[model samples]
Target: MPRERELILGGQRSGKSRRAEQRAADWLALDPAHRAVLIATATAHDEEMRERIARHRADRAQRVPGLVTVEEAVRLGPALARHSEPGTLVLIDCLTLWLTNLLMPAESGSASPALAETAHAGLLHALHGARGPVLLVSNEIGLGVIPMGREARAFVDALGRLNQAVAGACDRVTLMAAGLPLRLKEPG
Candidate 1:
């Protein structure tokens, strides 16, 4: 059977993550050797972020026992290549954060478009060649009002483009709202 590639997008608290996890569980239950791996992109740079990460970890433990997690903040292509296999299910929770990490000025003090472009290209390439099922989660932030700040606007623009590219590559695309999934695209 051909592998499935799905893109899940939603607003805050829309349950996109939960839906992805459930799908992963279902995929793993199909075969004894099927493995589920989470590719986490968020970094705990602040107390709130740390707490959020902890909560996600706890929730995963309670919900998906067989799921393994791999933290790859920037180098996503290599990570995807390393984990994806015929009987494996790879879930990438939140791409918006990864874009933020790329666009936001780091300790070195400036954002690098060249780096972001490279990562984006790498991700698309990896997704196209994935041997197993892949699920990607990202926020639908473009639904809100336009931001007043330049950086915020830039982020929204970048995220919008990224989402579009991924959605085009995916065989299925779902939009979550109020914990309900509305299918946007499905394989014909």
Candidate 2:
């Protein structure tokens, strides 16, 4: 069992993902030969999102010179389970999108609780069973007013629950804001 599980959470534009990436890069710097596993959760749903994803990819390339990025829009647990190993640092960029993907409908149908439950179980299993460092980035959506719709409320509720579940299993947890890290949990 490798000792590496971290969580970073913050509001939008809070530089949470950047902070997570920087920490991952720093960890890799200590051991240059360690494999860099970047699990991207963003989906290219629209032109704006596609551009944002593209920019994020470019930034990752520039920041971490030799990074391996794996784009898994929905099934992240399987991907993480497959690539996680000793001497590897897996950095997952934004769990919010992944949660959305897991909770949202494929076409126009209603969001299925059974599917979300399965995805949640898979993610937790992967995180707890990982063999190397796993840094997960996610948004803190509970800082705002109550949502105006049932779906939005359900999504927020699910995300908050998921964040808590991951954080509970992490060795260290940090909240980023304006590119600064506020340590929530630190290794003993």
Candidate 3:
């Protein structure tokens, strides 16, 4: 794989995470010395979510046995910095979940707006300074009608802005629909 930063955006079940995993798997297949690390940003807040995470883990392991997994719900900047290396591919499985962990914490009084901003900035900086290739997966939830609740609206807006920022930072951006990828930005 080329040394580039790529972002994948899609709706739920639109195959964003699957595309990122495929890229990581392809990168790992290139050489024995190559390494791939998946930064999982999902946090289990309920039983169903916990089970979903477990299922994803099992599926990913079967798909990419060589890809190492690192569970990091918050502090993604630090996680990316620590794992990014010259011969390594760093894949973030989803950015919206990371944003949720920031803006809408399951436990109240854990994160503030300023904290979220700082984390967001830190992630951008880490991306700019990464020594290896990176693939980021994120949701594109703004394609439908506006949300009803205030919190839902806020989350939607936040994710939209976050996606724009990451897309600008990446060398390539792709939108997935029905398991097919449409290239939005090509690396120059």
Candidate 4:
């Protein structure tokens, strides 16, 4: 399947995306023919998010000049499958937002429960079957206080399960905090 798969877990502003970008840049630097593509899962619903995405776009462009990007929110499995090439590195900016989209869709009744389950399975299958390298970024939000709302609690639990499954599928797993990485798992 994948040449290498890495899962980067962290909180907000914890440098997970930066590390993924750096990995992409390094991969591109290794060979002239090497390529990198970032699949962004975020949808800018508000002005603040729009600015944040724009800032990330500009910063990533400056940091990794040879990198390309593709925006995919729900259909990430097919997108990943399309981008996974032997000479390329595919990076998924964040899985948290993707989960949110599938679970609590912004468009009310757009995403059904069965659809979310199918999409989640598809994503894991794609990761396992990738031909090139894959870098996944996800938030670690279960460490904080318990949320009062049932929906909030369900989201946290779902994310935890999703993270666990992704981590198990990955070749390496790292926890990021204060821009530092603590390696959790690595292939021997």
Ranking by lDDT: 3, 4, 1, 2
Candidate 2, 1-188: lDDT as tens digits: 14579999999999887787787778778876777789998877679988988898898889987678999987888998998999888888879988887778555556677887898889899999998999999999999999999889989999999999999999999998887889999887
Candidate 4 local Cα displacement, residue 32, angstroms:
0.8
Residue range 63-137, candidate 3, lDDT tens digits: 999999999998999999999989999999889999999988987846466888899999999999999999999
CA lDDT, every prediction? Answer: 0.91, 0.86, 0.93, 0.92
TM-score attained by model 4: 0.96
Error of 3 at 146 (Å): 0.7
Indicate the worst ten consecutive residues by lDDT in candidate 2: 103-112
Per-candidate count of clashing residue pairs (backbone under 3 Å): 0, 0, 0, 0
Steric clash pairs (candidate 3):
none
Error of 1 at 1 (Å): 7.2
Candidate achieving higher lDDT, 1 or 2: 1
